[model samples]
Structures are given as C-alpha cells and as structure tokens.
Target: MALRACGFIIFRRLPPENIEFLLLQTSYGEHHWTPPKGHVDPGEDDLTTALRETQEEAGLGLEQLSVVDGFLQTLRYEVRGRSKDVLYWLAELRDPHTTVTLSPEHTAFRWAGLDQACALVQYSDIQETLREAHHFVLKRNE
Candidate 1:
C-alpha cells in the first residue's frame, strides 16, 4: 500500500489578472519545493488532511481559502523506496494580499506565476499538476 498525503494547490490573483501559485521549500531532505502537504492521519478523511496540513504548514486555514470545485489531482511517486500518493485540490486565497506564516518544517515560501512555479518545483509531476491547475482556473473563469 502507498502512503497517502493531501494538500491544496493554493493560488492568488494579483493586479492585471496575474495568477500566482504558492510553493514552500522544505527545511530538510533535498530542500525540495512543493505546495503545503503532509501525510494523512489515521481515521482522517483526505479533505480534512489537506485542510489540516495547509493550516499547519502554511498557516492558511479553511476560512482563508475558497476551495475550487471540480479540481483535484493525484500524483503517485516513490519516496525513499516507498510508494507515495499525494492529492492536491485547487483553492484560491480569499484575499490576495493575505500573509503566509510558515512552520519549522519549511524554510521558505514563494508565490510565483505558473512558469516560475514550474521551474522552482523539481518534480515533473508537480510541474504538470501546476500547469493543469493553472489551465483549469483559466477555463473555469472564462
């Protein structure tokens, strides 16, 4: 069985209709960058895990985010020889100017446009997920 994790693909819209996605750099390991995420706790549902992880890791809670409808992506990969599955759901910050507070697990964070975000994230699956989420938001707003 694969280890499961969940998080939000958080985005904010700035002036001139620029949409930026949030990415955080881990303090440990290879210092990889990714959206806020963590392992699913026993007996907790996926959405609950995503919400909890977002709040714990990014300081953004359910009240600050407007979860997007019909948008979720699951990425399966190997971590330290163990299969891992990460589920990411699209969400928009209720206020674009809201600040993000990071916990000790992450060393830094950035809000970047799709291209920059893709470049910052080392994993190919994450890059693709970001691209897809970007397009999904664009299409939904049209």
Candidate 2:
C-alpha cells in the first residue's frame, strides 16, 4: 500500500496583492524544505490530517486560515522504493503577519513568494502545485 500524507498549501497575501507561501525546513536528513505535512493516522481523513499536521508542525489552527475551494492537488512519488501519495489542500492565512511557531521536526519556516517557494522546494510537482494554488487564488478573487 502507498503511504498517504496530507498537508496545506498555506499562503498569505500582503498589501496590494503580494502573495507568499509557507514552507518549513525539516530538521532531519537532507534538511529539505516543504509544507507542513505528515503521515495520516488510521481512521483519519485527508483534510483532518492536513489541519492536524498544520497545527502540530506550524502551530496554525483551523481558526487561522480560510480554506480555499477548488484547489486540492495530489502528488504520487517514490520514497525509499515505496510508493507515496500526498494530498495538499489550499488555504489562505487569515492574517498576513501572523506568527509561526515551529515544532521540533522543523528548524525554520519561511513565507516565500512564488519564485522563492519554488526554489526552496525544488521539486517539479510541488512547484506546479504552488503555481496552481496561486492561479486559483488570483482567479477566484478576480
């Protein structure tokens, strides 16, 4: 069976429409940066895992974000010769300047604009997901 995970593609809009995405730097292994995500527990649904992981990893609760519609993306990849599937739900941070508290799993966090976020993640699938989220927000508000 494929390992399943869920997370949010969290972002915030600054004045005059500058949007930045949230990425967390993992403390272990390659110390790569990714969104706040984690493996799903048994009997838990995808969105619930997303919200729970967001809170545990970034200290952002459900009250802090406005979940975006029509913006779910799934990516399938291989990790250590095993199949993995990750689902990402899009959300807009209620406050652009909200504080971010990190858990032990993450050493740092950044709210990066598109180019920086894409550069930080450095995976084609995640970069594409960010693009899709940005496009969805822009189109939704237009």
Candidate 3:
C-alpha cells in the first residue's frame, strides 16, 4: 500500500530583497526538514489534506495564505521499505510578518531564502521541490 501525504510549498516575499520558504524540522524519522505535510486523513481530499496539515503543523490557516495556481509537485520515496507519495501545492503567505507556531511534531522552523532553504532541507527531492516552487513564483510574476 502506498502512503499518501500532502503539503504546501509556502513562501513569503521580503520586499525589495528576496523571497523565503518555510521549512520545518520533523521530530521523528531522520529529523528531516520538509514543508508542513502529513498523511492524508480519511475522507479528506488532497487540497483539504494540504490545508489541514499546514494548519496542524505550522499553525497557518487558509486565511493566512494565498494559494498559487498551476504549481504542484509529487515526490515518491521509500519509508521503511514501503513506497510513499507526497504531493505539494504552492502558496504565498499573505503577510511575511506572520509568526509561525509549530506543533510538537516538529523541533524547529525556519524561513530561509533559496540557497539557505536548500541547504537546510538536504534531501535532493526536497531541494528540487523548493527550487521548482521558487521558479514557479518567479515565472508567475514575470
């Protein structure tokens, strides 16, 4: 059985400088850094799962985000020898100043620029995901 998860590639604009992505360090597993994501709960659609997990993990709600259209990423990997698929949608925080309240599931959170985010994420899949999301926003703005 494939495990399904959903999350947001959440970004914030810092005005005249750069954009930053949000990453959370998970308390479990290898303590990997990832955008807020969790297993899709029963009866929840993918988008709903994304929103719920974001709120649950990062304390960000739908009201605080502006969903960016046309950007989605699917990543597949093995966890405990079982295949797992994670889907991520892109979003922008309405206010860059908004504070993040992390759940116990995560040990820390950071809002970092592209290079910093990639370095912190460490995983090739997650690094590429952040790169793609950064380009997605830049393309949209162009």
Q: Return the lDDT, model 1, position 4.
A: 100
Shift of residue 73 alpha carbon in model 1, Å: 0.4
Q: For model 2, what is the alpha-carbon lDDT of residue 31? A: 95
> What's the TM-score of every candidate structure?
0.98, 0.98, 0.97
| Candidate 3: tens digits of C-alpha lDDT, residues 97-118 | 9999999999999999999999
TM for candidate 3 is 0.97
lDDT, candidate 3, equals 0.94
Candidate achieving higher TM-score, 2 or 3? 2
Tens-place lDDT per residue, model 1, 69-112, is 99999999998899999999999999999999999999999999
lDDT of 1 at 87: 100
Alpha-carbon runs more than 4 Å astray in model 2: none
Which residue pairs does candidate 3 place in steric collision?
A: none
| Model 2 C-alpha lDDT per residue in residues 89-120, reported as the tens digit of each score | 99989988899999999999999999999999
RMSD of each: 0.6, 0.6, 0.8
Ranking by lDDT: 1, 2, 3
Q: Per-model C-alpha lDDT, please?
A: 0.97, 0.95, 0.94
Candidate 2's TM-score: 0.98
* Candidate 1: stretches off by over 4 Å: none
